[model samples]
Target: MTRLMDQEQENLWDSVQILSQINAEKAKAVFKVTIEKSLQQLGITVPVFSTIRLSVPSTDRLSQLRQIEKKMREAYAHQEKEKAYEYLVDYIERLSQMTEDDPLVVRKKLLASLLNERYKRKPKWSAKRYRLSASLSPLLSKQVAAAYYTTSEVAKKLGLSDQTIRRMCEKGKFPGAYKTDGGHWRIPRKIFITTPEQDERAEEALQQIDIKNQKAGYVDEFDL
Candidate 1:
């Protein structure tokens, strides 16, 4: 959280990002009360985060092919197998360079082949010893939790200036979000909802906020 302020970035901490997958309902309720009061005093709204469409950079064929391979690894790590398969198919298609004639059945087999390589190797790896070194021990350090997105990231995505996002955040437009002592906004990703409904947009963002709070892990928090 401090890192966000240090870099003059947008950093939001909401129920989902805070609790991740922990099911301490009682604790959540208590924290909710405290957080609401804090937000009210700060004049920042909840859902400080919001979705904006960001521009994609130009990619040559070689880079695009590398991205497909990297995406396969990412989707699999996120446990998004369906997406992983899609990436796998994309990889094979690039290899074949024959998208016009390839069939889905063939692509499916290629995807399976990709998965099989990992599945077969999984059992062969030996477990490594785990230890907490003195320098890395919890007693000597304060661990600050985090999510991947930042204020700069959101601005880049929305194709707007960071100052605009920061201004919106400061105006109490996004509830469950707050400005830090240094004036940077701490925003959760759920705050981004691009619906045309004037009144329902906040409502939709709030619903997502609740859903993410109930779930564990940041990997699937957005579901966007």
Candidate 2:
């Protein structure tokens, strides 16, 4: 509320503040009656007032409520100032409309009319950030696999560095592991092996060939 030169104007500002401060529905109704009498005396229209309750729990909620209240107060003050601006514009428009000669005045009034246009609502960080933190915490700190090995454990078992294992999984070289809420990684036991079987098979094949050649071929000339 602001100081006014006239006692009637002071009463009107007081009525507005008083009406908005009433928390209970019944009290607000009585305040509105008082405001009506003030309005009749001042010959001015009163703005509608809405009460908002903070429902969240905890100390954080207290800070959030205070911040919201501060912003709401500023918004109300802005609205009141805008009303004064609109009154001046209305006065000018009335004068311009009487003359019906100034196109620039008409354009200015049209632009001024849009000054109090609806503000776009912004997303609240309290709920959004809290939910997002919950959602992502599971992803980052989960445990998932047969060996109860985290992805890091699987990497260590495979003789690959942790960074290399991550790169391999990202490149689709190895299957992904599951993650649990407790931040453990579990890899499928099938992907890990004792050694490459192909090398063992090649060694057996070479021994078989050497035995066959020794049996079929004649002895060396020196041995004969």
RMSD of every prediction = 21.8, 36.8
Give TM per candidate: 0.23, 0.20
TM-score of 2: 0.20
Over 4 Å off, model 2: 1-145, 181-185, 195-224
- Candidate 2 overall lDDT versus native: 0.35
Cα error, residue 100 of model 1, in Å, equals 26
Model 2, C-alpha of 34: deviation from truth (Å) = 91
- The candidate scoring highest on TM-score is 1
lDDT, residue 203, candidate 1: 33
Error of 1 at 106 (Å): 33
lDDT of 2 by residue, 1-224 (tens): 12221343333233323223322332233223332322222222221111111111223432342233334334434676455444434433432332223646554543443342222243444322222224565654342222334566645343336765555445544333443445433444433322123223323433433464477553231121
Model 1 residue runs over 4 Å out of place are 1-145, 193-224
lDDT of each: 0.40, 0.35
